[model samples]
Target: MAVEGGMKCVKYVLFCFNFISLFCGLALIAVGVVVQVSMHKTFRIMDVNASAGPIILIVVGLLTFFVAFFGCCGAWKENHCMVATFSFFLSLVVIAEIVAVVLGYIYRDKVKTMIDNNLSDMITNYKVGSAELRETLDKLQETWKCCGAQNSSDWKDYGSDGQSVPDSCCLEVKPGCGNGTMTDTAKVHQRGCSDVMSIFLKRDAQWVIIAAIVVAVLQLLGIVFACLLMRAIRGGYEVM
Candidate 1:
């Protein structure tokens, strides 16, 4: 009886919701991988825990994927046990997603602060830093097309030849191109990499937050539908 009438509609909705959730899980995993790569590329010069945020997202995404599989099977089979289990697991996924979002937000702020405080050191370390570190900074500047920690002048103290910027900061690249051009706006990038990259970092973080929040909100409907379907099945309604 419970599966008849509107209960039938509820059952189908539950199935559709889980279908969407399967894709949602895949999306979360993809986003996490992208963000993880960006974090390492952008903040590798600093001491940020670049893996933690993305790892959390990926784990939750895997959980969501498997739970949605349970949901789809249960809803289709009219099985009470699987439906109940699906609801419980979906509830946990929602919570885990929220937590992942909060952690991402916190990590974003911490990275921003770390960049501000450590940019000087990063610039100073260019000559002394390991090959990997120098390459990362060079790529950072070249990709962002920005100069020093704060501006071109920030390189005035760099290397033995003070008042020179890296060739990576040149408006037009050539050997020793940044020599004696610390504040030369026409020759080297004038903006700071910290300021330039921060904009992109913030934008990425916002997308991650929005994605997680949207998925969490949407899954609530699935949870409710699963519960109703479970109820219908447990009542011995013989849901078709």
Candidate 2:
């Protein structure tokens, strides 16, 4: 049994969408790996709490990749069983993402606390940490234009070269630029990294939410189309 006319078009569109989803899954996996590796290389190798986000991304991506492939195969072959299975699995995936978003919103404060504590630990260990850690800290400070975990004053007794703030925190970003500049707001950034990250997330979070919504909508459409195709197949209507 197969579908005719519009059902045929729906079949091809579903296939195309699943093809696109496969690439999206690969992209998510790549991004997750990058984030996880970055976490490992910085902030004293993030604890399990900090590692959960990336691991979830990786798991979701892997599941998406396989399920989308299943969807594509079912659509192309017009197989009732495969199409039904794809629809069920895709629904589960969409539900899981929605749950993740809701949980993230509810636990946002805890996330902020974890980031703050990790950054503070890094600052506390900077004086005795390895060269790689120091370099990573310098890169972070330079990139964010932030002074310390909570502000420049947080470095009252700590620095790289017997100074109050590291040279990376200086406006000029040159050696000795931070010397005698802890009190000079013009010379060093007064804002803390934690605050900077918070500001950044507050400003950019809407974009992430928007993207998630769009993805969820697209997946829902795919699930709906797959179910329709399954129904047509079961009813012995030609969809090819």
lDDT of 2 by residue, 1-240 (tens): 544488988899999999999999999899889978876544343344556667888899998998899999999998988888889899999999888777766765664576688777778888898887788778888888888888888787785544478898898898878887886988999888888776665455556657777899999999889988887888888765
TM-score of each: 0.89, 0.85
| Candidate 1 lDDT, 1-240, residue by residue in tens | 434578889988989988888997898799888878876767564546645667777887788899999999999998888888999988987887788788777777666666766777877777888888778788888888988777888887775678788898998878898998877778999998878877776897898689768877888988888888887787788776
lDDT of 2 at 155: 81
Worst 10 residues of 2 by lDDT: 40-49
**Candidate 1 runs further than 4 Å off:** 37-39, 103-109
Best by TM-score: 1
- Candidate 2 regions off by >4 Å? 1-3, 37-48, 159-163
User: Each model's C-alpha lDDT?
Assistant: 0.81, 0.81
lDDT comparing candidate 1 with the true structure: 0.81
